[model samples]
Target: MPKLIEMMKPWQWMLYIFFWALFVTSIDRHDLATWPQFFVKFLSRIVQYTLSIIPSLYLIDYLRPIFKRDNPINVSMKILLLFAITSAVSATLVMLVMINTGWLVYERKAFVLNVLFNIVITVGFTLVFMLYFIRRYRELIALKQSFEHKLTAQNDLIKARIAPHFFFNTVNSLVSLIESNPPKAADLLQHVSALFRATFDGAREISFEEEVELCEHYLAIESSRLGDKLVVNWNLPDDDVMYDMVITALTLQSVLEKMLLNVVEMTTETIFIDITIEWHQHRVTITVTVQLPSKTLMIVHDLRRHVNFYIQAERLRAYFDQSADIQSDVTNEQIVTVINYPLYDVSI
Candidate 1:
């Protein structure tokens, strides 16, 4: 009964109550002589209808699992049959009460007609309500699938942009490494090859731990090239908040690579890059802060534009159903990039 009430919309409940009122009024209109009698009959009918319909609805709910195993046509037939049987029992009980209370005649013909009318009304209401609810459910499902498809397309575009951007930078780093340290260049190639293979495995989402590992590898390759000029700091929480949570693939790595590349381009001196990960209120936040020289203050705008373009923050928002938030702030001393997304635990 609670499930039935929850499943019904406000207007649906109103319509259901209205139908019962109309049914009762139609059957007892001849008895309504005065205002007092009308009120009494209406109130009595409301109680009677409630008593009858609640059990019928409860029976339908109880039988839903069994009905679902059958085909649609069979399910409809079984529901109609159930409604017919329950309505017959309810009408017989109402007739007994009406006759005993001197509200109805004791003729066989009148009693038969009353039971038939009750069956018709109850079955008709059940069929109409079921059809309307099923149609609306299908419509909602279709809309959800359509929205998901659009999000997938947008994520694919973002993935395409990230892969080439990271590849180009890694290749450039390899070039520099080959000139200075041939052995490290070969090792970087092996790492880059493994990263490339993982990227093409066609995974739309990845675990937070896996994403952080990818970022670390990318930073390692870059660190080899830049040496002492680049300083990387990681501050990851020791808790299990991020253990099962998943986000779009390449999300963390793309932001980290983009920010570091921008910092390297804007400064020739040593730069400190701080990466912090924390969990708050079912959300995972990644903050990357890079200490920038005062002379490169004007480069913030260019960095913002590049990060927004390559990271596709808006696309991430859509992919995560608007649960992702990405923002950038630049000061004279540092550039801060913050990415927050709901911790979607697949295990749950």
Candidate 2:
């Protein structure tokens, strides 16, 4: 339901409420004195119901996380209970409004089936919501699958990175450097530990500074192993404020690792990677361009690896949804990937 609420646009909400408001008004149109009264009632109900529904929408969204792990049976029962309570409260408020507005003559008899009328209205309103929920069924299922698949991919990638030639090579390098340069080796070991911790941190988001630090740690370890085979050119803003912005966890780490891995696998030649960070109109764009070797372009370009990396990268996209995305351009010479994401609610 949180996902559902998150996915729905403002226009969708307006359309949804407007449709149900008309349905509720129509149910009472038969009792109106004339067509003019019916129209008047519909307009009034639109204003009143829209105002009333806003709070309920917020309440439902607020309660979503609490009920997220509940069983289907419990969820269904809870939904029914909430609807009943909302209807009863709305009915009481409507009755009071009618009395004060001179729409109803105040009397005990005036109460006349108010609860029943509200029950009927609730049924119609609930249907409207159910219909909208049903309409988002495809997207909800896709999102669920993406999350499940992402978890599997992340675990697999983490396992591969943690227990491989790269990890072994870094360890080997650390061992040799321990006697030669104890301080440098210790720093390298710390970076390795921090890199591993960053990946498994279980954080949904982290500051841009942390992300950049992770990237540098990654490159440091890689530089130790690959030596002159890897070259990274960093282009960044002079302003420190941009680094205070936030990005989804591993948003840059995963992609940069994958890109570096792709190049490392193909050749022992010097691989050039340029990473640039820019801030414009309250948005942050990080661009990474990896230069491909002539031999690799002619010999092999593994599409499957790129596709897997893309799938993994898609996980971070869910954080901003429409406000952010990652894009890439592949050519004969290089693959240029740009990660564009917005920064808001940030204090620096």
| lDDT of all predictions | 0.72, 0.71
Q: Which ten residues in a row are the worst by lDDT in model 2?
A: 298-307
Stretches of candidate 2 above 4 Å error?
A: 1-22, 29-31, 58-146, 200-205, 226-231, 236-244, 248-251, 258-272, 279-284, 291-308, 318-327, 330-334, 341-348
* Model 2 lDDT tens row, 64-111: 777778885786567656676776676667667867888756666546
Q: Hey, what RMSD does candidate 1 come out at?
A: 6.4
Clashing pairs in 1: none
TM-scores for all candidates: the values are 0.62, 0.66
Error of 2 at 341 (Å): 4.9
lDDT of 2: 0.71
Model 2 alpha-carbon miss at residue 12, Å: 4.5
List residue ranges in candidate 1 displaced over 4 A: 1-149, 163-165, 175-186, 295-297, 309-311, 344-348
The TM-score that candidate 2 achieves is 0.66
TM-score of 1: 0.62
Put down candidate 1 lDDT per residue, 195-242, tens digits, no spaces: 666566543667778888777777787777677878889998775766
